[model samples]
Target: MTSGDVSLETVTAAKAGDRKALEDVLAGLQDRIYSLAMRVLVNPDDAGEATQEILIQILTKLSTFRGESALSTWAYQIAVRHILNARKLRDRDLGLTFEMFATDLETGLVADPPAAPDQALLLNELRISCTMAMLLCLTLELRLAYVLGDVFEMDHAEASRILELTPAAYRKRLSRARAEVIAFTSQHCGLVSNQAKCSCPRRLPAALKSGRIRSGSYPNSAGASVDYAAAKQQIASVVDDLKTFKLQQAVPGQMCPEDIRGRLTRMLSHPL
Candidate 1:
């Protein structure tokens, strides 16, 4: 995704019908594309499907690589468009609002910790799962902005180009999205807000009984973990609103699903 000459060379080689070049280029993009799709759809199955489709489109349209943008930007443009279309066909609404969630916070939700050490291990797993799932409440557009800006650490100007918005417009959207996520998490997530009573342990039992968290495939934060005390201090800082978003972003939830790259690569080998 770095700028300058290497990107152009890769695109040029891939376009010129170097099979290895095409494979290598696609290998690099598969996970990033899948990650974006997962944020949009909040389902690994859907994200995998979308990633394969997007990869095919990018490969087939390589000749149109105009160099006006980085290949990553161009690829993301295709990805954003495809994901938008897919979302229209899928369920795109969360039906819950920050206002609704804010109201829920007043009830003081809490859970009893598991007595056994084995269950304690599972509790950690649930924390990450719930953290990732919380993102599903955001509208697809706002979620996309947050993922692009905060999670992926993309700059506003480039993110604007990817989302096809003016830089100022993109900033406005990202700011609003960041604020909503921060406010909700601060009031509802135990890790983000120490005073908040809602912790993953409280929800783990229900999630397990419902078959949401399976046996071998334990959920994880995917990126680094943030200490609750540190996060709490950051949330209380002067610029806490913005700082909270960055802290949460530091704890990324997941990347692509397992075997996605292999599945797509095999599928690609056969035909269009």
Candidate 2:
């Protein structure tokens, strides 16, 4: 749910110990929290764990939420802070560098790739997985800058506030992130340039054989069928490099599994 969907009355009630209102408040923010975490962390398991911890932090601090900013902004600020510190506290590392990722993209590419299989959304899986994987190459700070500033299309002021940076500082970080991403994609990704060696179709076979994507098991498929060429053409039609990355925002938000979600709510009652 969007921030606009969460009412001020609900926030007030939640802050005042209304259980139902607390649930509503957290519910409105969960998907957004998960989405941001997924983009920054690039692992479903990591994002899920992060979402739970972030939500719990929000819950504990709900009373202090003075409402000076929008609830979504407050929530996002909390999420960003938590994720940035989480790596240090937990010793978590994805260990991806741009040079390594560039090599990975070029590896196992099919020069004359066979036709994309039409069975249950393999192409979409490959497309989404590759795009998400690309973000892993960036440092967490830059990745968050790109996800908040570009993928979500958040306003500069709002994004800066969430990132807790001055507007100029935020812009500089985003510029660096945008430049790094655009430079890599422009030279390598077929969606940004036809001359690029790696297209989704060319990568599909290696992805399947490597067990990166199993056939018909993608949990978040959006369409009955995906036209690889059409999608590439549509994304490539945009002339701007930064704008081209925006088109890749089709990666669906990750959600917590039901059992984990239920456990999150139970935290309120159990106080763990």
Candidate 3:
């Protein structure tokens, strides 16, 4: 899954002390691991540290691979769990609710785009900025479940496994998350809904001036899209109404500050 080649054999080999198999699994998962952290932590620097810790945890626990879950699923469990704990200790709450978002949007306190070039590159930066900031507004648990289940398009069972919750509990979390986010966007966020005044294009100028996104590397290379049809079924129509739009799945490029594999591998070379 993600980038890791999945097979019963690789899991068995990894469990049987095959270092190469373990490395291979990590190699395939490195991007996804960082990507998850980027979404959960909402800060690239924190995400980098979380990736290092997650890899180490996986490495130390490789022998315990029970095969009940896919290797990627197991890895994701470690990542999400670790992030939840880290966020609790760090106290980085977004303090956002539907009320706040609606108020901000209706009052026009959100992004104030200045004069700037209207290009796809600038648009990418705006998307990244708005999405990341919006994620910050949600509660920690809600944000993780929403990202895993909705944005990344992980099924309920798989997302639940990663969150170490039963299917029912996970489903409720995901539903609530989707409802709140969808309702807010329907009334506010310009990315998916129309009522709100702020959109990515309108905000890119201000983001550029504040150094939120750099000029170069602002535009992300076109990425393959994930199927959110299942998540769509769970969420209401606000997101599904978007046609050929990137809002549902597109994230800003350059959200990750470093190459996850390189950073973690380098960290592993050092002693505790």
**Clash pairs of candidate 1?**
none
Distance from true position, residue 199, model 2, in Å? Answer: 1.3
Q: Kindly list the per-residue Cα lDDT of model 3 for residues 117-151, writing each as its tens digit.
A: 54655565555555666666678888888888878
Considering TM-score, which of the candidate structures 1 and 2 is the better prediction for this target?
2
Q: Is candidate 1 or candidate 3 better by lDDT?
A: 1
Clashing pairs in 3: none
On TM-score, the candidate that comes out on top is 2
Q: With candidate 1 superimposed using the best TM-score fit, by how many Å does residue 202's alpha carbon deviate from the native?
A: 2.6
Question: Which runs in model 2 stand beyond 4 Å of their true positions?
Answer: 1-4, 88-90, 114-120, 220-230
Q: Please give the RMSD to the true structure for each candidate, in Å.
A: 3.5, 2.6, 5.4
Can you write out model 1's per-residue Cα lDDT over 1-272, one digit (the tens) per residue?
44232366677777887766777778767777877876666556667778878988888887888888787888899998887777543564557666675454334334554543455446555655555556767777787888899888899888999999999999999988888888887777765667766665565555566676654455453343654344445545635466556555545445655576676566556544
lDDT of 1 at 207: 59
Could you give the candidate ranking by lDDT, starting with the highest? 2, 1, 3
Distance from true location, Cα of 218 in model 2, Å: 1.2
Worst 10 residues of 3 by lDDT: 224-233
In angstroms, the error of model 1 at 37 is: 1.6
